[model samples]
Target: MWDACPIELARPQKCAISEDRDKLYMDFAAPLVSEDLTLVEADPFQLMVRNGNQTCTIKYTDPSNAILSKENACVFAVNLEQHVESDLILSPTRGCKVLANRNETNLFSLSHCEKHQPHEESHFVQIKPHNKQCHTYCPESNLTFEGVNGKCPNDVWVMPMNTNFKINDVQFNGSRISIVHQETLDHVGSMKANMHLQSSVNWISLMYEINRSQPDFKPLPPFELHDYTHYVSYSFCVVVITALSLIICIVGKKLNNLPQSD
Candidate 1:
């Protein structure tokens, strides 16, 4: 007699896959085996990755898209962080205010009183960038004349005046005059008077007053007198022609008066 034998086999284990690709997929029936697996995620600005017990961070703009891994760390794939808005505003028109004063000799202070009394001018006022100093002139008079003292920087003392002097309308030595204030009557004065300072307070102040009355000031080119080359050439030609005519007249007169031999 022979006995019948029956055997039962084990069923395969079920498997499940994670929705996120960053996670690994495995089946219950699969044997546990150690293998290196890398999970990566990317966005416009940055890249993140996770590997066996490690995390890697990368920038999208990097020249090479090489994978980076941490020595020992955990990785997280997070949404891009929002950047805070800047709180800065710009103005349409921007400008700076400047106070400029011209330095001059025999500089007088003007009174804005209705009577307009002229103060006894003592020391010359020298207004500068940092401070104002009282300078003494040669004669210490209202009509002060500046000379080449050799102490001035340019070897000349510039007389800056807020008076009526039309430097633009005057001409000198093959060059135009470039006065500080040309258009405004308030700053116009005789170039000679300004250079020589031979005018009275009333006259000088009048020029300054006129300039102040004007609303707008437009600079004019200084007067320039150039050499008259054409005139000189004409004169030279006239002299040459006159000399030639004189020689011809003398020769004609000698020929006419020649002695006749019979």
Candidate 2:
């Protein structure tokens, strides 16, 4: 009947890639969710964290073929999707700044993609280190202390006995903290619920998550410590001592001027 129509071939065309190396990605920390919800599982979507060892892809190929619609398909409506997860894999040990992973020798030597550590040419003793003020200290024992909400690092439990609404028996178990809810002043052991904890490092976190809406939950300000030592401001303390001394002097003089009895 008829010889097959002449075979047709599509020509190969190279994708044009243009890149500006100036752009860079930065770090972000999402706010921690509340304790009422538990994160049984994460998205399982691995996102890359950028650091000094890697550079942005100075080049990428734009895919050749573009799909278009019969109507409303124009240059303005076009969106290009690329495989952005592609990245260079560096050794787990290389360019790591973590103190445990890399020792002082390595950490101190790291440039952090900068030119060099400050005063690299000078002796270590010559550099003055940063000084931070300590909120708590013991002069007798020569011990320096750091704390949050007036609680020492060793005693970090948050007790909620004094709130307008009360939370009871806050207990930690298996990546969760559970507490009872009560409206009255006295502690109640009846109601209990758990909140999810996302992560922790050196410090304990108060931020947590719960499964359902926790209407009773409210974030409170940092604990206010009391001055049990009967502390007065320096100026007021000085004034009180001076007044007492004057009164004592006057009374002693009056008594001494009187008859010299036993």
Candidate 3:
């Protein structure tokens, strides 16, 4: 007799499909744990990018937020030629003038109403001493006798003199008389000495009287000379006089003795 009907076919097994689904989930989860991940905000001033072997810097005036936020971004280089213009020329009338003198040169005249201009047409006046008073004849002589006197337009009087005059030495020869005057002026102005010969002794007397009238020009304190040669000469004179007197006395004595013999 044949086997009753056929043995019930076993249901297709679902375990293999379940095992495949679980393996797919594990593979996706493994990548998430092993891969490197980073999150950072973008900076407005700087940009960074990765090159083949090194990092490059990108600088730009203004950049979009999207570009800055992108990972590995760089700034575009700018050409300055298109952005710059030529320099402008400024006129002289735009500046200021502080101090000005009128007696400097011909160009500088006394005009109070004239205003100073800057870059256009400007003139500078400088007052400089011409050393006209300094005597070039004898610098090493140290006998400077000169003074300066001038008047400004504003009625200002400038009397420049050498206050350092001193009598270093005096030589009185009939023909060539020399007197040394040493002096230093307050400012580095000019110095000069004037000498006049007078035939009339009255001029000298007048000068003496005038000098006497001025109390400030009085004679300085006397200076004593302690010369050894002078003292020696005085002692020598005294000894010579004493020796002469003794010789005369001895002669007289001899004469008296001879008379008695006669």
Candidate maximizing lDDT: 1
**Which stretches of model 2 miss by more than 4 angstroms?**
1-89, 92-95, 100-203, 207-214, 220-243, 247-262
Candidate 2 Cα deviation (angstroms), residue 120: 56
Error of 2 at 244 (Å): 3.5
Instruction: Highest TM-score: give the candidate number.
Output: 2
lDDT of 1 by residue, 49-144 (tens): 222222222222211111111222222222223321231112112221121122322123232212222332122222221111112221112331
Residue lDDT tens for model 2, 11-100: 334443346755554434333322222111111111111123321111112212122111221111112344223421111212211113
lDDT of each: 0.30, 0.25, 0.28
Return the lDDT, model 3, position 93: 24
> What's model 2's lDDT at 18?
40
Poorest 10 consecutive residues of model 2 by lDDT?
A: 189-198
Task: Please provide TM-scores, in order, for all candidate models, with all chains considered together.
Answer: 0.14, 0.16, 0.16
Query: How many Å off is the CA of 5 in candidate 1?
Result: 90
- Superposed model 1: Cα runs more than 4 Å off: 1-124, 129-243, 249-262
RMSD of each: 35.1, 30.2, 42.8
